[model samples]
Each structure stands twice: as C-alpha cells, then as structure tokens.
Target: MRIGTMLGDVLRSLFSRTATRQYPVERAQPPTQLRGKLYYDPEQCTGCSLCVEDCPAYAIELITIDKTKKQFALRYHVDRCTFCGQCVESCRFKCIQLASNEWELASLDKAAFTNLYQRAENDASNVEKVAATDVETPDKE
Candidate 1:
C-alpha cells in the first residue's frame, strides 16, 4: 500500500512485454485433434440414425431421401452443437467428422447455423423444401 511500492509496480508493468498474443492478426495453428465444425459424407452413410441418437445436444438430424437408393441428407444445427465429437464416435461408416481447421464458425445470420449436406444428384428443390420446413427456429424474445 506504500506510494513508492505502488509507483515501482506501475513502472514495471508499463515497461514489460504483453502477455497475450494478437489473435485475429497473428493466428496460431489449431491442434490436430481439435473438434471444430461437423462434416458429413452421405455417400458412405447407410441412413443410420446412430449419430442423431448419440448427440447429447440434438444437433444432428438424418433425413431419408430414398430408401431403395440409400440417398440421405443430414441437417446439422451448429448453434445447438456442443462440439463434443459424439456424432463422430457413433457413426459406424466414418461418414462424420469434425474439421480441425474450420473452427471459425461465427455468423450474424441465424440461417447460417443450419447446414444441409446432400448428394449433387438429389433433387435440390425437394431437399430445400424439406430443410426449410424442418429446421427449428429459436423462439422469439
């Protein structure tokens, strides 16, 4: 509490190097096993809802496009996701994974939180309709 001691401490702090790094400007490499954004490959998926069942946050939804053709689409709610990697672990076909380099998922738009992954050959109009209709919107304030 002495004036001299306080003055000395202030001077030392002023001359010392910053303890934190500049984040956005000087980005560091992400870790190899970092759980970032969720990804899905429908080609290998067998329409199994194991990922949906295992998700603690209810972030993933598997929609069956064609049962005979094994065509499917995955609706991922990023905002609801906890990035826990439970979906990745539950998927037996290895169709799901968390991209390590894609950690920057921030967005101002509410629509951006919902992602639909489907094959190029599938009917875009139908899938869009399904996605739009099924996507749950947060309750108004």
Candidate 2:
C-alpha cells in the first residue's frame, strides 16, 4: 500500500461517524416479537406442567404449594433457558410469556439465575425455605 493512500484512508475513517451505538447509556428499544426472559403468573396458571414439559432446556418447574387453593410456585432456571418461547407456546392458560424488554439477564451471582415465583399471599417462610434448598449453585472448587 502507498503512504498517500494509507493516510487518505486513515483520515476518512477518523472523519466518519462511529458505527456502533453506546449500548449501556443509550439503549435501543427491543422489538415486540423478540423473545426474552420467561415470566410466569401463578394466578392464571392451573398448576399444569405443560410449560415444564414443553421446555427443551428443562428450565421451568411448576410446583404445587396447595391443590385446593390452586397455589403454585414456579422455579425458573435462567441460565438453562434457551429463549425458545416453548413455555409461552405450551401454556394454555396464558400464564407464561417472554418479556421483550427483559433481555439483559446477565448476572455475576449464580443464585440470581434461579428464580422462584410464588403468590404474595402465600407463606413467605415456606417459599424461602424451598428456594434455599432447591437453588443449585455450581461448586467453585
């Protein structure tokens, strides 16, 4: 390459506008159809394990707290999820969905990857105990 041509190219690049967006500070709106983090509503859920069964990555678990009251808890493994929207598709009661705005799920804590969702009126202590025991973290060894 000639020095004049190289200098011209460098000058052109320096004068041109930046191609990349400032990701964290200036965010772009996610599309409506974009599949993101999985959300579960226990109130609408019928305690059916269809979402659990439909998940190819086995990321969702539906646990029954009380059969009579239809109380349930959803254990979601975010790290294991593939964002395939299978759980959302399988749910007949419209209890599960993939939030378009919740795509940024990166976390340093392993416990953050495991989410336990239960009704507010349900026993918090019981749910906490269950979460404590059920949450599986990798050995740091």
Candidate 3:
C-alpha cells in the first residue's frame, strides 16, 4: 500500500455518501409480498385447527371458549413466529393473514408480542356478571 494511493483512497471514502437509510426520518417501504405480522380474524374463522397444525414454529394456538357455540380464542406469539406464511396458507376460511406494509415489530418485553384475539368463556362470563352487579346496585339513601 503506497502512501499516495492510501491518501487518495481516504479522500474518496470521506467524500462518498452513506449507504444506510435514515430509518426514523424516511422509513423503507416493505415489498408487496412481504410476510409481516400474523393477523387472526375470529369472526371469519370457524375454529378450525388447520392453521395451528400447519405452523412450523408452533406460534399459533386455538383455545375453545364456548363448546356449544364453537367459539375459539386465537393466541399468537410473535416471538415464536418465523413469518413463514404457512399458517396463512393453511387457513381455509382466509381468517389468517400477514398484515400488509407492517415490518416494524420491535418490543422491549417479550410478553408484549403475544397477541390474544377473542374473549375467553370465563372472561365473558366475568364481564357480564360484573355488569349485572353494577346495574342491580341498591341506592344508598
């Protein structure tokens, strides 16, 4: 490495533009077919465990809330998810899908990433009981 060549290289490097993008100022757009966060639509879903069975990372779990009504609660853990889109593909009702144009999924706590969609049977009953009690409260004269 000659001194003259080293000096020339250093000068060229100093004048070159930065390759990194200013993420906060100008966020990069995700590709059209990018696999982002997993979204579960309980209204559209029929409690079929196909999505759970197909998930390679075991990130999805379906809990039956109402046995008579066939109501289910979907538990999705983003930390365990690989964004492979297998669960999305396996869903027959099209209730499972990767959210579009959403790539930023950072979280300080792992517990924040676990998304529980749909109310449990016990939860619904508890809420209703609380409301009933509130409504039936006697007035203090």
TM-score of each: 0.84, 0.85, 0.75
Q: What TM-score quantifies how close candidate 2 is to the native fold?
A: 0.85
Model 3 C-alpha lDDT per residue in residues 1-141, reported as the tens digit of each score: 999999999999899997788978978777889998888877777766888777777787776655477566677889888999998888889988898687689989877798776643347554344434432221224
- Name the candidate that leads on lDDT: 1
The order of the candidates by lDDT, greatest first, is 1, 2, 3
Candidate 2's error at 99, in angstroms? 1.0
Query: Which model, 1 or 3, shows the larger lDDT?
Result: 1
Worst 10 residues of 1 by lDDT: 132-141
Tens digits of per-residue lDDT for model 2, 1-141: 999999999999999997888989988899999998888898988877778777778787667777688778888989999999888888899998899999999999999898878897878679667655553332324
lDDT of 3: 0.74
* Residue-wise C-alpha lDDT for candidate 1, range 42-139, written one tens digit per residue: 99999767888788887988777776998889989999999999889989999999999999999999999988899988886798777665543323
Clash totals, every prediction:
0, 0, 0
**For residue 67, what is the lDDT in candidate 3?**
48
Which residue runs does candidate 1 get wrong by more than 4 Å? 130-141
Tell me how far the alpha carbon of residue 84 in candidate 3 is from the true structure, in angstroms, after superposition: 0.6
